[model samples]
Structures are given as structure tokens and as C-alpha cells.
Target: MGLALKPTDTLIVIDLQNDFCPGGALAVNDGDTIVPLVNRLQQQFRHVVLTQDWHPAGHISFASAHPDKQPFELIQLGYGPQVLWPDHCVQASTGAAFHPGLETTRAELMVRKGYNPQVDSYSAFLDNDHATPTGLAGALRERGLGRLFFCGLAYDYCVFYSAVDAVAQGFEAYVIEDACRAIDLHGSKAAAKQTMVELGVHLISSDDLL
Candidate 1:
């Protein structure tokens, strides 16, 4: 998302798309359940930003794209161990489109990632290696938003990584846990919560904001 809009303590919506919701190619567990809460939260935050996973068809993250690799299988990328996904989030595909349930009107900026055929991006702030940084932090900083609120889609992956990177980059970060679902890959949902606890990231329910 470009930072052209008036920003107010930027609210980052991470990965709210069809492929991550139920009945899509790579659905998260109970992913659609968070849409209502996210919609509600959008009403409270004015400077809303959204991240979309706009992968090319047969991008490197897909198991099908890599012969001998299978979905949920791990492979060593130049970055490190990466999990292959069921072909998903293809750009312009129905599964890659923003989830219809997402309240898009509130979003002033919608950042699309994972489009690079060679790189898979989980965090809005960085690609998987943490080597490349997306301009989210800089944009938020430019807008004088030192504090950021996060909600949407997979709690364990995008949401978790985004929150961690936000805190690591000196932005106060808040995660609305109730507004996110999890992939729970090998019980990652629990691990993510633990990591947040250890990182001193703030965790709150959507009710806490009300």
C-alpha cells in the first residue's frame, strides 16, 4: 500500500483473501470466522492498510510448481526452510481476489505481495528471509504512525510475522487475536502466540479496543 492517504495510526490488515478462507485452495482453519470482527475493527481505524498475496500462477511457493515437492512439505530455499502450499493466491484468480466479506472501503492502501516468482512473502514488512523489507514501516513512519494495529486472515503466519517485524522496527504493535485465524501448520498457532508473548508484543481481543 502506498502512503499517499491521510494516515491515523495505521491499521494493517494482513492477507484477507479468498485463498486463505474456507473453500479456497489453501484455506486456513476457521479463517472466514474473523471477517466479521475485522469488518467491525475497520470502522474504528481510519488509516487502514491491507496486504494481499498476489502470487503468479505456479509461483515458487506452490508444491505443484516444484516437482517432487508436495503441499505441506518443506524444502530448502536459498532463504531457508519453506513450506510448499497448495497452488493458491494466483494473481487475478478468484482465489486471489480479496475476500468479498472483507470491508475494503476502509482501506486507503492495499499492498500486494508474493508476486515475485522467486520469493514468498509472509510479512508485509519483509519477505521470508527478512532480507528484503517492504516499505510499510517507512510509510507508517512517514505518516507519523509509530503505533500500528493488526488484524485479518491467518494469525500464525502473516499476522504473526507482521506484528513481530513491527515491534522489531520500533513501532508499537497490537494484534487483535480474535480478528485472525490460523493455518496451524504443525500446531503453529500456539507457537506464534508464544513467540508474541516472548517478544513482548501486545495481544488483545477486539473487545479490548471497545
Candidate 2:
């Protein structure tokens, strides 16, 4: 039997910005293909939240900010290991905008993360250091929303971190597999899935919700 969505359940569409889609700066593999599926899935949820990767130019996470670093190279920041990324998702830029074809009218909240030039935010709920919050947890609690279903670009990073943080915050967390795509850097996808399972975050399919 399929799982039924409830009023307390929320669908978190994460980082569906132009930069994460094909032909953009930090494009993920087959990321654009899931848009239609995500749009259709959004219709079934009572509460929908959207997340954007809104970074500033010269953001610490960008490879260009480091004199000798290259994209995909890892560097140690005060927050810990940080993956240097190509310049993308600059605030107020085209790449920072949501994918044009994505349906957003139903979203009850839009949480923009990574806006701070000092920190790199992958999880919608918290910054990369895992300390500074995006205020999403409090907002969801205020609305009495507990169960969270996550879907969007770069499943191995943003989606994975968000779902893990959801479980950490005492919410029922699930990741809709088909509605997500992965950057999968250095086997991170497999590793993330394993960690999520160990952490009690459910890995499910969109059909399960449908």
C-alpha cells in the first residue's frame, strides 16, 4: 500500500535553481529530467516548501574565491572540509533563479540558503558547519509540520543533508528518490544513501507517495 500524505507532512523542493540544472554552471547529471516529476508530486502535498542555493559573489564555497583552488577540489575551512564549486548561484543572478519550468505557486514557504558569504549551506535546515540554522526547523515546528519529504537537485548533497537534518531535528524524514538527481561526486551518492539508512531517514520512491 502507498503511504498517504497528511497535513503535517511537507514536500521540500531543494535547490531547483537554474545553476543546478543541465547547461548551468554546477549542473548535475540528468537534473532537469526530474522537474516534471517533481511538479506532479507537488500537487499531492498540502504543505510545500522550496529551498534555493542563494550565494553571493566571492562566497567562500566558490573555487574562484581561492587563489589556487579548482572546482571539485577539497579544502579545509573552519567549518571543516568544504568542496570548492564553480561560480554559480550568485545572488540576484540568472543562475540563482529557480528553474523556469518548475511550478512554485503552491509553495507555502521559500527558504533561501547560502546567502551568507562566510558560510556554505547545503542543508536547507542548517549551514554546513551544522550549527547555524536556516530557521526552517523552527518555522516548520511553528506550523506543526513534522513529516518532511525532500526532493530536488543534487540528491547526494543538498537532499541528503536536508533529510539527515530533518531526522536530527526529530522530524519524520523521507527522500523521494525518483524526484531527485545526484552530482554523485566520488561515490558520495552510495555513501550518502548508506548513511541516511543508518540514520533512519527513509529512502522512498515517488510512486510510494502517489
Candidate 3:
């Protein structure tokens, strides 16, 4: 029964939205690869949560909003350096919707983040400012979810931040590498792996669970 999960553990699916999928805006490399595995993993956890990067149309993270700025341009935001993204995941738009094709059987809660036009929220726990919480950590705490298993798009961004923040918030966090995809920003994948290792995030493949 090792790592088979319990009522005290949670499966957190981060940013499984249309804009992050293959062929969508801001699509991650190999983003489609992990969907089926994540869908399958859903059956193994009783408390499953799904996160959506639900940004407004004119989000501050968008380079287009800054006129001369291009996608991936570095910008100064409150927390520190923030990358400008191509316009994506505009709230209430079709691209912001979760992939309906996913097997979301165990998803008990859906957490929506980045609704604020002024801030970009990569971590499911806290917005980049480290000021406003998305309330996810408290939700997990209230539910007594000590062991957090994370999956989803772009291993370099949302998934990584969420996993790191989970551990920082006192939840034992595991990142299912095989259940996550990467944006791979010019060796960022390698860097992200190193960062996770240093953060004490357990890296497990999907096959480890199966």
C-alpha cells in the first residue's frame, strides 16, 4: 500500500486547461502526453483537486498588454522578475476552460487562479507577490491532506511552483514527472529539475504509482 495514497493525501492537477495543451496558445512541449496518465491517476485518489490558470483577457503577464514587449520578455512585477506570456487562458473564454475530455472522476474541488489583472499567479498557493493566497494551501490543510501528489502542464512553471509552495507550506509534496509536461525554455527544464531536487521535492514517474 506504499504511496497508494490515503484520505489524508491529495492529488493536485495543476493548469490542465486548453491554453496549455498542444495546439493551444502557450502550449507546452509534450503537453498532451500526460493527459491520459493523469486521467488514470485520478482514480487512485479520493481527494482530487484541479487548478486552472484563469487570467483575465488583459492580464499584466501578457506582453501584448505592454505594447512593445514580446512574449517571454522579462518584466518587473511586485514579486520580482516575471516573464511576459503570449495572451492565453483569458477567463470565461473557451481557451481558459479545462480540457473537457479529461477523466475528472475524483476532482472534488476546482481552484481557479490568476483572475487579478495586476498579478500573475503561478503557484496554486500564493500569487507571485507572496501576499495574496489562492486559498489552496488552507483548503488542503483544513482537509488534513498531508501528502500532496502534483501533476499537470508545464513542469517548469505552474506545476513546479505549486509543488515547491506545497512543501514550503508544510505538505509533503511529490511531483509526478511522467504526469507533467515542460515548457523547456532554453534549458529551463534542466534547471527546473535541479531546483526541485534542491527544494526536496520528490520526483516520481507515473509508472511508480501504477
Q: Compared with the true structure, what per-residue lDDT tens digits does model 2 show for residues 1-210?
A: 389888788999999999999999999988999999999999999999999999989999999999998999999999899999999999999999999999999998999999999899999999998899999999999999999999998899999999999999999999999999999999999999999999999999998988
Note the residue pairs that clash in candidate 3: none
Task: Please report how far candidate 2 places residue 129 from its true position, in Å.
Answer: 1.5
* lDDT-better candidate, 1 vs 3: 3
Clashes of each: 1, 0, 0
Q: Model 1: how far is 43 from its true place, Å? A: 0.9
Two-way TM-score contest, 1 vs 3, winner: 3
Question: Would you estimate the TM-scores of all the predictions?
Answer: 0.94, 0.99, 0.96
Which residue pairs collide, candidate 2?
A: none
Ranking by lDDT: 2, 3, 1
All candidates in order of TM-score, best leading: 2, 3, 1
Cα displacement (angstroms), candidate 1, residue 126, comes to: 0.5
Q: Which runs in model 1 stand beyond 4 Å of their true positions?
A: 1-7
Per-candidate Cα RMSD to the true structure, in Å, reads 4.2, 0.7, 1.4
Candidate 1 residues 31-115, lDDT tens each? 8888888888777777899999989888889999999878999899998988999998898999988889888987877888888
Q: Which is better, 1 or 2, measured by TM-score?
A: 2
Cand. 2 TM to true fold: 0.99
